[model samples]
Target chain A: MNQVIETLLQHRSIRRFTDQSLDREQVETIVKSAQAASTSSFIQAYSIIGVTDQEKKDKLAELAGNQAYVAANGHFFVFCADLHRHKIVGDLESADVEDSIESTEKFMVALIDAALAAQNSAIAAESMGLGICYIGGIRNDLEAVKEVLKTPEHVIPLFGMAVGYPDQETDLKPRLPLEHIYMENEYQQDQSLFKKQLQDYNKTTSEYYEERTGGKRADTWTGQMAKMLGRKSRLYMKEFVENQKLNKK
Target chain B: MNQVIETLLQHRSIRRFTDQSLDREQVETIVKSAQAASTSSFIQAYSIIGVTDQEKKDKLAELAGNQAYVAANGHFFVFCADLHRHKIVGDLESADVEDSIESTEKFMVALIDAALAAQNSAIAAESMGLGICYIGGIRNDLEAVKEVLKTPEHVIPLFGMAVGYPDQETDLKPRLPLEHIYMENEYQQDQSLFKKQLQDYNKTTSEYYEERTGGKRADTWTGQMAKMLGRKSRLYMKEFVENQKLNKK
Candidate 1:
């Protein structure tokens, strides 16, 4: 594999970082890399907010479940699924894009546009020898995020990212087996085969955790997912999104 | 900038491909790079379908509005927003994850997961001197996609990508201005400023099109957006997603 693929495979979410922060040029390269990602029909329906204010960064850290890395990283960026500009475009052009912007298809486009751009930024940062972690915890309090970021309606901060030089190295987190994630043509829905694969992965993940924690913890991926998803958290997201006038077709 | 960042910034959708197909090793590396992407809560709520069968590729090419490249790329990958495996996980652990899997948050997770992975695969392929194009036209008809791909519940084909050796190289499309797309600490909700930036970008895009097409198409981005989003398309997507037992909350 080439250096690019090697860099991608080396990815690990860095939860802790050194005091070194990103420079303006580095931030420019990262954001420029993000701009190069594909958009749906060139709709360009996403916006990224780089949190530079110390107060806002601290508040966002608190909002993101007290993740200090969020505030103290090299740089923090809030990637938003924004359709507000499309509304402005409609207004400027005197075109009725209200129903289209409100449509679920467009909502998905915004989310995807944001995600593609974010991954580009993440890769760009990593290529520059920086570490990065995605802070989904930002969604813990969207209302607070809106207040802190002054996000208007039709714009939602989906996630934040912390980028910096690594303070520590982490063992690679084992991913789901290739067969489990990739299929040929049709989805391999054979439940028997699927169950066996997950069972095997559970063992691999359990072993990984055990080895990493020195036998303090060994849990299955399924168990972790079940615990995380079974419990009600972020239940307000749906209502929040709809109330923000997005994804409510 | 390093090669990785350079590869990312040079991205342009390659619609025409040489007859050279991707080998198994290349496909494995691409998919492996994809799996290395970050997943929320370790849910890994996504999967990639590598369309290898000639028959299925032809059908998909037809389904994707007869995009010939979809049928004849080095490889075609359909990035799916999959929570079916989570359902399986729930069943194995007997965890009540039905509501969680159905929530819009989970839907967003699946979509973002798929996109991050897709972009990784795109970069991986491009780094290897291959070119790629995302085929969102796959959503032109989801029911047909389900039938053709045999996708199950809680599994949606979000987008398709065609990767192969390039038969052509297109110029980089102009993106939204940095000031418009990137803000500091807060969303810059300045309509006048936003309009001016877009209007400026519109000129850039218009000149780009003019240079590329010899004035055959000198359209503004806002005009194109107004034309595309002003009209209704894919209205069935809302009901289709709900009917697929996803994002029903």
Candidate 2:
């Protein structure tokens, strides 16, 4: 396998990081690489905030489910789906950007653009010998995050990422088999074979967690998902998105 | 800058690819790298369909808004926001996976997961001297793509990617200014400054396109967005997503 392919295949989220600060040049390079990712329609409706202040990090850590690793990471970036820039474009051109910006499709473009750019940033950081973890817990308190970050209307925080040198090595988490996902020319409804493959993967995941977490065997993929569903993790997201002036076409 | 960073920074969407086939080992490597991407709660709610069959490619090209490049590209992968695996898991465990799988939150997770994995694949492919272009037009006829790809319910085609050696060298596409995106902590809403910067970028983009396309003169960023917004894109995404059993309790 190619080196890049090998590196990607062996990727594991690093929650623990060494106390090493990334150089400014390195950060700039990663951000530049991020900016280079393809944006839908070239709108580039995304922004990233680099969080360096320890106090603010502490506050953000609290907001994000008390993830200590977020506080200790060398660099933290909050990725936002931003339509504020287009609003500026409208202001300059004296054109009504409101008609276009207030639709669900526009909001989705921004969200997907943010995700694509962040994924590029992650890949760029990994290539530079940095370990990274995404903090979806940022959505835990969307309102508080908005206030803390002072996000303007039309800009919503989608997620956070922690980047730094790895403190420990980890195993690659296994995934479902390709057959479970790779379809031919139509949507297939074959469930029996897919179930068998997933059962084997569940066993693999359960055993891995058991060995790694030192007997703290978390639920299999199915059980964890069941628990997650009941958690209503994104209950606030809809209202938050609506409040941000999205989905208001 | 690191070599990988340089490569990433210099990335351009190469829609026109040479008539070369990717080896099986190369395909395996790219897919493995994709599998290594981060998944929300490790549910890994995404998958890719690799299309090498010529007839299938022709049909896909037609379905994806008649993009001839797709049929001629070396490799085409359709990324899907998939929850079907979890449904199968639920059935085996006799768990209420339907409840878990049927939510906007789950849909978002699946979409993000699919996008992140696809980004990884793109980066890995780029590092290996291949070029890629994302085909967002796949959503033009989402139902047709689902049917053509044999996608089961709960698996929406998010986007398609065409990859191969570049048949032509394209210049890098310009993005909005860094200040427009890389905010400090809060979103900066200085409309005047943003407009000035974007106007400058518009000029830069115009120049870049002029040079790259030999005076085929694409519209400025704002103009393009205005034209795009005027069009009726994503016509059936809402109903399609609903039909996939998402966004429901």
Candidate 3:
């Protein structure tokens, strides 16, 4: 395997971080790397809030499911799907702008752009000897997050991330078998082979979770998935998204 | 600026590629970098279909708005939002699985995951001295793509990308001003300030595009957007998504 391939294959979500802080130069590098990612038609429909204020970090930690790691992380970033820029451009050109910039395609483009940029930043960070973890709980209270961040209309917070040096070494979490994901040209409905692979992976996951939790095995992948599928995390997302002037379609 | 940062800042869409082919190791490294991107909940709800066959590439080129570069490119990759794996996993565990896996959240996760992975692969390719371009026209004939790829149910083809050594050098495309994107804690809806930035950027972009196309100044940012906003481009996406068993909610 190539060196980069080996490094990527060993990826793990790092939650525990040393107290070391990222300097301005490092932050600029990561952000520049993120801005380099491809955007749909060069619209660049996304934004990042670099959070370093201790008070704000404490507030954000409370907002994001009370995750202490987030408050203490050296470099925290909140990624947003933004369309306000276009709206502003429209106004400047004397173009008639929609009151709300929500359409299926537009929303999809913004969300995808944010995710792509964030992923690039993550990869660049890792390449520069940094550790990182994504915080999806930022959406737990969409309204509160908006108010806290003072986000304008036509933009919605998608996710948050913490970056810093590792405080502890952790094992890479195993992924689903290749066959489960990589299909031929079209989708194959062959479940028999897929099931076998999942079963093997579940056993591996069960043992790992058991060891981590020290005697508690939280069911297998199936059980956990079942529990998760029914749970409503972004219950207010529809209304919230609309309030942000998105997804009007 | 760091050399990597400079590379990223100067990124331009490379629609032209040389005849040089990528080695297996290079392909594998890009794929691995893609797999390493942060997936929502580690579901990894995406896959890449590597299209090396000329016949398939030619057909795909036609399907994607007859983009000549796609067929001529050294390597073509189709990134998909995939949930077929979970269906198989459910079968193996004897878990009650829904026939359709469409939900707004699931669809969002898959789309975001696909974009994230693809972005990582793009950056990795750049790091290894390759140029790339993303083709969103794959959605033009979604059903045709599915049929050609033999894609099973519950998988949506999102985008295609052409990657290889650049046959011609291109300058970086300018972006929207920073003030338009980087928001503070909350979103600021200051319209005047945003308009000013857009006006400046529009002038910059007008020159850039005019030079690239060798045409008298065509559409500015606002003009281009006005033209695109209402243009119906195969946006039966809602129905298409629902058909894939996604966005049920």
Index of the highest-DockQ prediction: 1
Model 3 docking grade: acceptable
Candidate maximizing TM-score: 1
**C-alpha positional error of residue B210 in candidate 1 after TM-score superposition, expressed in Å:** 1.2
Q: By the lDDT metric, which is better: model 2 or model 3?
A: 2
Comparing candidate 1 with candidate 3, which one achieves the higher DockQ? Answer: 1
Which parts of model 1 are misplaced by more than 4 Å?
none
Model 3 lDDT tens row, B1-249: 444455566677899998998887787777777876778877778888888878888889999989988899878888998877766555555555452245566677788889988887786787677899999878778888887887777788888889999998988777666555555455556766767777777788898889888976656777777556536355576567678777655
How far off is residue B67 in model 3, in Å?
0.5
Per-candidate clashes come to: 0, 8, 20
TM-score of 2: 0.93
Chain B alone: TM-score in each candidate?
0.98, 0.94, 0.94
Candidate 1 residue-wise lDDT at B122: 93
TM-score between model 1 and native: 0.99
The CAPRI category of model 1 is: high
Tens digit of per-residue lDDT, candidate 2, span A1-249: 565665677678899998998888877877887899888767788899988888888889999889998899879999988887777666656676786676656776787788889988987888888999999888888888888888888888888999999998888777767565555445555666666667776787788789889998855766676566545566556567778887445
Query: Candidate 1 residues A1-249, lDDT tens each?
Result: 788998999999998988887899999999999999998888888999999898999999998889999989899999999999888889989999988888889999999999999999999999989999999999999999999999988998999999999998987899999998999989996989999999999999999999999999999998999899889578788899999888888
Fraction of true contacts retained by every candidate, in order, equals 0.86, 0.50, 0.36
- Cα RMSD (Å) per model? 0.9, 2.2, 3.0
Clashing pairs in 1: none
| Per-residue accuracy of model 2 over B1-249 as CA lDDT, tens digit each | 666676678788998988998887777667877888888878788888888778888988888779988899878888888888777666666666675577656766787788888888888889889999988878778777776787778888888889988899787777777766787666675767767777887887888778877899855777666566556466456666778897543
